[model samples]
Target: MSLTLSKKASEVKPSSTLAITAKANELKAKGIDVVGFGAGEPDFNTPDNINQAAIKAINEGFTKYTPASGIEELKKAVCKKFKEFNHIEYNTNQVVISNGGKHSLTNIFTAILNPLDEVIIPAPYWLSYPEIVRLSNGVPVFIKGGKEQGYKVSAKQIEEACTDKTKALVLNTPNNPTGMVYLREELEAIAEVVIRKDIYVVADEMYENLIYGDKEHVSIASLNDEIYKRTITCSGVAKSYAMTGWRIGYTGSSVEIAKLMGSVQSHQTSNPNSIAQKATVEALLGNQDTIATMKEEFNKRREYMYDRVCNMPLLHTLEPEGAFYQFIDVSEVLEKEYKGSKIQTTEKLGAILIEDFNVAVIPCADFGFENHIRLSYAISIEKIKKGLDRIEDFLNQLK
Candidate 1:
């Protein structure tokens, strides 16, 4: 009598950040001056040269389909990129280009994960890791890290979590929520366990060029030869070059993994947009001075926000050595009353801040950390300072 939708479509939860964005928009449309710190994107625009390249491609009728894996030129650019940045060797055949960093990860997860295979993810990770693993029919296992250890899981925890069913592990340096970049020494320890356990590692370096303070972003695959053989290096121009709308990301792995991903790409979405490919080639080979300028701006904002938030009495904020986020532990302010509403969860904290103070930040519960909330410093310094001033006032009242 009626058609039904697949269970896969129904099982997916609405994306966490998107929900926050919608609510923020609803408030903003009603003339509220809300400072949004929820989105994980740079506030910069795509570089002019890259944008021109896309225009040139479109004018020249470069609007057709590409190989499912990617165009040869784009793959070659990716090959040159790995050699230059990470000191890893890759041929064109070893790379596959997809829609965005998210799509690239989903492709990698789908290509490799068999049903019931376990994927080991570090806690306080990207919101999509566990979701993608589950969507691919893989079991997601998490190992938690705390502020005491600079928000990093140890080799012991990783080794303890592994079993015969373990298939893949995700390693995100200068990680999304915490912005904790793994030191080379720390990565070497994890890599040792990984190489011994014969588990595949997905090295997510989406924020590779955005380090600040004294921290350095290390590519885990570059540490050792054995780990390189089993690593899928994923990244995009989105975070680094402010090309989020370009929807181009690439991955480098063994030829076998690349080809299998190609198969997945063919059946699901075929090739990515040809214009994005041409634009990405320009981005990869063009002068990188723009990236340096953006990094400098982000660093200034990061330090300013870090110093201010870390000094708040009721909040415990760790200074992230890299990335533009400050993950603030907010357990001290969790009481039964915030504007007369019971404030128990970080979601409630965020909601109260939105309703009363007109600020938008992500509650940390969705990132597998219950006692925290993430504030992004990607906005202008004036807005950041003003928002913090408002938040500080609200927290003082709670105390």
Candidate 2:
């Protein structure tokens, strides 16, 4: 018999962020002194309280198959979180806990999208959005948000992108890669568009707790009853509580959508990890000071990285308002020659940096921008300084 594979699975692209991080790790394993800037998780360990919660659960033999949706306690905690943090009121029945934020998104798209339905995703988006949409048999429609706009799409742009087949719009605040947060007015306008178009809004607030400066995270679903009815709000303890490995994410939506996602999750991966669920409960309701500390440290790193990149010749980046990434525009650098050959692309520049400069950076082609690269500050300040110095050295050598 000829070898065969699922066409849908074959068509999906691997996550560039993970691939770059893996390569950086591989080099480190080989004893190379690589200063990596590709990490997406916090450098800090999970809080001791959260860890203790997991240990306590294990000691109590809390490991077992939970309800396909999640534990009632976790669901109630998520509902409380939504009420207090996001200003959105959702009951336990409206929530579904999954393996991770990505899994929550997968369940969402699976529950809501019919074949060929369109999901309007802004450009320079989290690289996984388009792939996940495609995997769920939904088409991804992109609208670009240029550098001048702080990498955020306007309500007008979103309104223009919609069609009769539009099923949803992805709104990621404290966005990955760009670190830009949408303003309240901006979200209000977008919410109006979402309602007028009568489409679902997938509010991905994974980095909600990581916003820097005076900017605050505002969930579009909280704006009004109409948009709330049409929105599915997703969040997790990964970024906020430094629990990426815990694999716990939850969402709030209508009871109908929640049931569908739960039913789909039942066969896919019954409940999130039992211990992780217990830990997540503590993460949501515990001390909460750790998040503020992590945010402060991340702000310091963000300022340092932004200043360094701004001073580097032929490199440009907007001051990131939130999250822990600096989305650098490397177009000028790519146009220049390094080692007597034109760099030409973000991938080539990244490869040269890793091979010669002993630095790892994520090239952003898969993120819908060919001339940009994302540098994450989710590492120690010392490592960040080293990586920036190498990047500056590389740029200085570009003729």
Candidate 3:
């Protein structure tokens, strides 16, 4: 007899963005000049102060297994960060540290979801949300957010989508793929819906510090007391501190939910890395100037990329207010052919761009958007210029 994987494992889709990045690397290995904009991680190195803290922890023999939830000191630091910046109060027990932001989210889903429960997700979402919900035996219901809506759904939309089966809502501000940051008023409107519907909210604010211009990130949990009880605010040091390899993420929620998540994590992975937890304490309580420096560079690249997209005749995109991606609308040229081969979908266009133009971008089809593609500005300014030039040249050739 042949062995088979579980039904859930067989149905889950692999990330299309990662696939394109792998192809890009393969071409580069063969000495091709490939300009890649496919990575979701920052290109910068971890700051020296953060690195030094981890080194100190290692040298001091602090590498043993910590508490399942996390070390008390690191949990306390997370509380302080929430209080100071997000204006949200939480005791140490209300926070749970996991291996990464993704792990924190998985723990929440496993704790909250039951069979056939529904989770409302806004479209043009991070590709992982639906799969994670499915893995927890929950159903994901999507509400589409097009360019007209600033890629943000309204409170009315959320209200209409909710039903008795709805158990949670996944809200991502400074959103992945679209880079849309919800304003204070918008968040207030959504909070009302969550309170009325009596559903949990998973607020992913991973790119909160990377916002540009006069824009600010407002955590929905900080808006009021009831919303605080209903929301799990997820963040980490990966994007802001350039510490993706460190693998530390944290969440703040009600004590009840936090305890349940801690319990779920205990059976799954035991604890996050001990050295990384110590480093995160310093990342939160130590010097924050590194964040400002990285934001400055991201802003420069954002402006340059936005201007280039604006000048291109057929390409269109919203000016990204936060995060480091430019989600471009490529429907205008999708119907055209390149050398008698039709490029009718973003996936086909993406593959051709990498194979012929030597440029790689993520197709947004898996992100629930068709005829659109996403490019990251986390790369160098010179590379951004070259990639944009190649994209424009490729569009010009579409017949």
What TM-score, over all chains together, does every model reach?
0.98, 0.98, 0.99
Rank order by lDDT, top first?
3, 2, 1
- lDDT by residue (203-280, candidate 1, tens digit) is 999999888877777888888789999899999989998988989999999999999999999899999899999999
Clashes of 2: 0
Candidate 1 lowest-lDDT run of ten: 333-342
Q: Report, for all candidates in order, the number of backbone clashes.
A: 1, 0, 0
Which residue pairs collide in model 2, if any? Answer: none
lDDT of 2 by residue, 1-399 (tens): 899999999999977777777877888899999998888899899999999999999999999999999999999999999999999999999999999999999999999999999999998899999999999999999999999998999999999999999999999998888999999999999999999999999999999988888999999999999999999999998888999999999999999999999999999898789999999999999898987888899999988888888888888899998878899998888889987999998888888999899899999989887799999999999999998898888877878
Flag the better candidate by lDDT, 1 or 2: 2
Error of 3 at 318 (Å): 0.7
lDDT of each: 0.89, 0.92, 0.93
lDDT (Cα) of model 2: 0.92
What is the Cα-based lDDT of residue 65 in candidate 1?
85
1 versus 3: better lDDT goes to: 3
Scored by lDDT, the top model is 3
Q: lDDT of candidate 1?
A: 0.89
